[model samples]
Target: METKKNPNLEIGRNSSIYFAIGLNIMLFFTWRGLEYKSYEKDDFAMEILDIGEEIEEDIPITNLEAPPPPPPPPAAAAPDVITIVEDTEEIEETVIESSETDQDDEIADPIEVSDVAVEEVEEEVSVPFSVVENVPIFPGCKGKNNTELRNCFALKMNEHIKKHFKYPESALEMGVHGKVFVLFAVDANGNVSNIKTRGPDKKLEEEAYRIISLLPTMEPGKQRGRPVKVPYSIPIHFKIQN
Candidate 1:
């Protein structure tokens, strides 16, 4: 028996080839549809810039005034003129002798030195009471020797101070009290002078000086048989009894 269809001409033989071509065509169309681009359209208007026209601004002006000039200075005075005068009197010229001498000249004879009188000049001397030959004599103080006179003078001084000592009221109120050392000198004329005092306060010094100033004039102390100043110092106590 023989087959009715030929093998090469069968319909189903190219079905796969046709299906592949159709599948490829569908895939290409699907890919093109997925990759499709769409955008909204916008309209832009055109405008032109004109820089050819120019703008101008106005500025204000200021005027300044100048200062006045200073006045001229005063004129100076003219200097005095001096005139020259010629001398009219004739002057006599004195002849001067030269002192140079030759061997023929004899030297003047030696000046005679016969007798020269010397004058005794007494100087101002100061002597201490202890070393003086004669101590200053206090009032009613008379002694044959220096020792007795010293004792009597010291006794008299103490008595005088006790008799005249008076404390200053100001010093008492101010409570200024101390021992004031009073220094005084019996001059060559036997007068008390140069009284000085040192103490804790001025009130005490004034009182001490006043007390010493009341001392009576005494006989001046003598050194080498001549009167000399004798310096004496005494302590004046300014104490409050209370």
Candidate 2:
């Protein structure tokens, strides 16, 4: 069916162009209303004054003289001369007797001196067992040579330890078993000193120390014909037999 078209619906097609033109016209009127204005100019009046010239005065001059120098001191007087007098007298000559002694009239006697013994002072020096020239001699290692004496000393020491070996009762009960290192020194006087021990347990260490301390006195070690303290170290084993 055919229907009549309204003109108001056709004007909507150009409505966007009409809105843009109206917005541009409104922005131009707003910019003109907010235009910047410059401040008004002010007039300044200047006044001139005349300055007078300054006058200078003249200075007076006067002459000055220095005083004369002081006079020098007076010279000292010379000393007077002394006169000497001489007397003529004769002197007599004297005869002197000879004081020489004859060898036949001289007497001589012999002087006798008693004997004096000097005590030797021994210096305490620590010498290692391996490097000592003369090793300490054990109780039963007498009459042995240097090398033989060293071996005998070691053997006797082991024997002594084995003979005196007794496990600590407390250590055995606690099952503490290990090797203990014992260090001792033979002094210049053939006496054992400085006994020390280290082990896993204090009981074992005490036992080792007891055994080492029981060692008999040995002949002191020597170096360069002089006796010296000998330091020796040994390890003792404490093991449980299965």
**Highest TM-score: which candidate?**
1
Per-residue alpha-carbon lDDT of candidate 1 for residues 85-152, written as tens digits (9 for 90 to 100)? 99999999999998999999998977566665668887778888888889999989989999999889
Candidate-wise lDDT, in order:
0.90, 0.89
Query: Against the hidden true structure, what lDDT does model 1 obtain?
Result: 0.90
The alpha-carbon lDDT assigned to residue 201 of candidate 1 equals: 93
Q: For candidate 2, lDDT tens digit of each residue in 133-194?
A: 99989998865478888889989999999999998888888899999999999999899999
Q: Estimate each model's TM-score.
A: 0.54, 0.51
Model 1 scores a TM of: 0.54
Lowest summed lDDT across 10 adjacent residues in model 2 is found at 38-47
Distance from true location, Cα of 190 in model 2, Å? 0.9
